[model samples]
Each structure stands twice: as C-alpha cells, then as structure tokens.
Target: MYKINDFSRLSETQAAYSAGNTNLLLYDLPQHYSDEYRSYDSPRLCTIINGAKEISVNQSEHFVYKKDKFVLLPPNSTVHMYLPEHTKALVYEFGDQLIDNVRQRVSDKLNIDISKNDSHETFMQDTLTQRIDALNRRIQEIVLENDVNMSFLIDLTCQEMVYELLKIKGSYDIIYHHQ
Candidate 1:
C-alpha cells in the first residue's frame, strides 16, 4: 500500500496514469483553481487527499472539504469550488446506470425500495471510513501499476465505491435527490 501522506508522489503517479487516457477517476492537483458555478451530469464523490476545498452551493451554503471526509454531489446541482495550492484530490463521477444497478441490488437485498422522495435536491458529506480508505488505496495502487487490465480494475473499484456509498445512512436521499 502506498503511504497516504505521500501526496506529491501519488499525484505524480495519478497524472502519469491519466496521461495515457486510462484513468477513470479525476485526480486533481491544482496550484490554485476556482470555478464560479458548474454542474455535473452524474453524481460525483469528491475525496480530498490533501489540502482543503471550499465549496458553495446556490451561493448560500458553504462547505469546506478536507482529508478523511468526502462530499457527494448529485446531478444538476450547481456549485462553485475553490482549491488552494498543492491540493490533491480524487473525484469519482458515478454513471447513472452503475448507480441504478447498485441501488437495485441493495434494495433487493434489504427488501426495501431505495429512492429519493424529497421535493428538493441536496448534497451530502460523511466521514471517510477505513473501508473506503482501503478501497481508495487499492485504486491508487492499481493505477500506479499501469497494468493492461487497469480499466477493468478501475471500473470494478468505482462500482464498489458506489455500492459502499449507498450503504451509508440516508445516502439514497441525496443520491436520488434530483429525481
């Protein structure tokens, strides 16, 4: 396992993998970056490995994302972001198909329909558990290896992440909020 504190090296490795167009996750290592307001077409889980990110939604609610915490942004939720220098982060954008697949499996296993019924859209944040950290480390390791089957492995990991996120309490509401 790669040392989690080795942010620079990890960023470099991630960049190298991404350059080959084999990266499924977005590894951000920005000196200073900001966006006024933007939205995604899919759900995105932003995990900060180092430094901090300041985010604001609707220009009203503000959040600061740091290590050991992650934010899940549902589709069509506009938000602004500001990242300081030397910030290392990984963003996993989950496709709707993958999310629905996992949601169905979980719902079937639990025998409960997991769907969003809220009238408004919302995002969520939670502490990064050990299981999630381990999976993330595995992803990093796999990317660093640059194996021929990197895409398959990365896809599996990303799917697992969606499954894991769904397991979190009340995640379904936020994930399906846009509905």
Candidate 2:
C-alpha cells in the first residue's frame, strides 16, 4: 500500500526532473537501478524515453524498451521496476478528473452511457507510445521555452495523452468497466 508521501520520497530520490505541480516526473536511472516494490496512489502512465526496464506487476514481468515504450499502472498496483544503465523514462501521474472529463465528452459525443461500468484496471498499449512520445517532446519544448501558457499546454497535452489511450481498442472497456 503506497501513499502519496512514498511517491514523493521516491521522486525526490529518483526523479531527474519533476514538475512543480507534481503531475509529471522524469527519471534517468543508472543501469541496474532496482526500484523495490512500490505502489501508486493514483493511476499513472510510464513511458520509456530511452534504454530498457523491467516491471513486475501482479506476478507478471514486462520488459518495456524502445519498441514497447509505455505501460499504464492502475491505482494501488504494487510494482517492481528494474532499470538498465542509462534508462530514461517519463512518469505522468493523473487523477480521475481528466479521465472522467474525457469520458463525459466521449459519451456525449456518442450518445451513450459510460457510467454503467467502472473498473479500475491498468492497461499496457505499445501502439500509443509514439503519440505519447511526441506529446512529451512537445511539452518539453514548451517548458524549455518558458511559455507563458505552460500550465495550460501541459494540461492539454495530458488530456490528449489520456484521450489517445482511451481511443485504443479495449482500453475504454478496461477503464470504464465496473466490477
């Protein structure tokens, strides 16, 4: 059971760069940097920018590298990650608000009721990695430029990332399904 403070501690120690709002965390871990068991308090998207890493979740091990660059961790999922030398990744921690808003918009657009199902499950989709990578690059550029609307751009990019995930086949089912 990980709390917010645990995330804070881990971020402080592992994060190479972290956003002031705490929504984005960038980690550049050395080879064989073993991240012991840890869980998140909220849903998060982990994207590998370079190198390779292994993540164990629910007794399953996943190797996320260049070809397969992203994994989504559901809230409260205990995970162990092993990063190879010079592994770099971006962690996007987000609440349900953005998802909910997107769901609402999607539902409204399709004229369907999405609230009938609500399940909290993590999803791993490699296909969406490229888009996320592009978004990350754009965000990084915007941040580097010190854009006055950095906050807004970040928020929009975050939403776009979630939207892209939701667009994947079966992703919406995983997220909106109820037990």
Candidate 3:
C-alpha cells in the first residue's frame, strides 16, 4: 500500500484520469485550505492520503478525517471542507451508470434486493483496510498507465470497490441513497 508521501510522489508524476463521466484525481493542497461549501451533483469517494480534513455537512458539527480515511458522499450533497495542513488525497467521482450497473449485479449475485432506502445522512466515513487500499492503488496504477484500455480497467476496478463496499454493513444506506 502507498503512504501519503508515496502518493504525493505518484501524483506529481501522473495527471488525473477521466473515463466516460468518472474522474480520478489527486489533490495536493496547501495548509489551511478551506472551502465554505462544496456541492456534488454526483456521488464521490474521497480518500485521504495525508494531512486531515475538517468537514461539515447539513450544517452539522465538523468531522475530522485523517490519513487512510475515506468518505462517500451521495449525489446532490454539499459540505464544507478545511485542510489543517498540506494534504494529499485521491478523489473519485463515480458516474451514475457505473454505480447502477454494479449495484444491480451485486444485488443479483447475492440474491438481495438492493433498492434505495431513504435515510437522513450526510456521508459514510471509514478507515481504509488493507484490501480496500490495494484496490485503490490498482485504480491509481491504471490511471497513471493511461493505456488504451485505461477506461475499461478503471471501470472494472471501481466496480470491484463498489461491490466490496456493498458487502459491508451500513454501506447500503449511503451507496443507494437517492437512487
């Protein structure tokens, strides 16, 4: 797994990648970076590689996130973000079709009806496990490779990540939110 400094170096050597509507970008922000309110029209998964974020959603109290942490925000959600120090992160915006397809497939394979459940929530936050970290690294590798098949590989890897998340408890609420 790559650490914060490793990711910093990797991001410096590679540019962001986009496929269809999905985007995977690396952010290297200076200390004290603040955004009063940032809105997402589509679902996003932000993974912190270094530093920390103080985020507030729905006018709620701020939540602090540090290294190896990730937050999943549903579409149409907005939040305020502040970086206390130099921060490096991987921000992945998921295309609607990709998420839908993956959800449907997982539901079918598991024989579970995966439908949207209304829930009053801001976002889902969790620490990265070894498996999840490996998956993220794979996506980064594919993006940096920038090969002719990069788009396909990214879609596949992200689908795998989504599938894994669905298997976790409580993720359905956020993943299928606003479906």
Per-prediction TM-score: 0.76, 0.74, 0.80
What 10-residue stretch in candidate 3 is worst by lDDT?
Answer: 1-10
Per-residue CA lDDT of candidate 2, range 1-179, in tens? Answer: 01121234554446323333237666666777776544356566776667877777655756555525667766666677776556766677765676778777776555443444344545554645578778878866766787777777777888777777776655565444421
Q: Which candidate is the best by lDDT?
A: 3
lDDT of 2: 0.61
Rank by lDDT (best first):
3, 1, 2
Models ranked on TM-score:
3, 1, 2
Each prediction's number of clashing residue pairs = 0, 6, 0
How much lDDT does candidate 1 score? 0.65
Top of the candidates by TM-score: 3
What are the clashing pairs of model 3?
none
Worst 10 residues of 1 by lDDT: 1-10
Candidates 2 and 3, the one with greater TM-score: 3
105: Cα error in model 1, Å = 2.2
Model 3 reaches what TM-score against the true structure?
Answer: 0.80
Q: Name the candidate, 1 or 3, with the larger lDDT value.
A: 3
Candidate 3: lDDT of 141?
A: 83
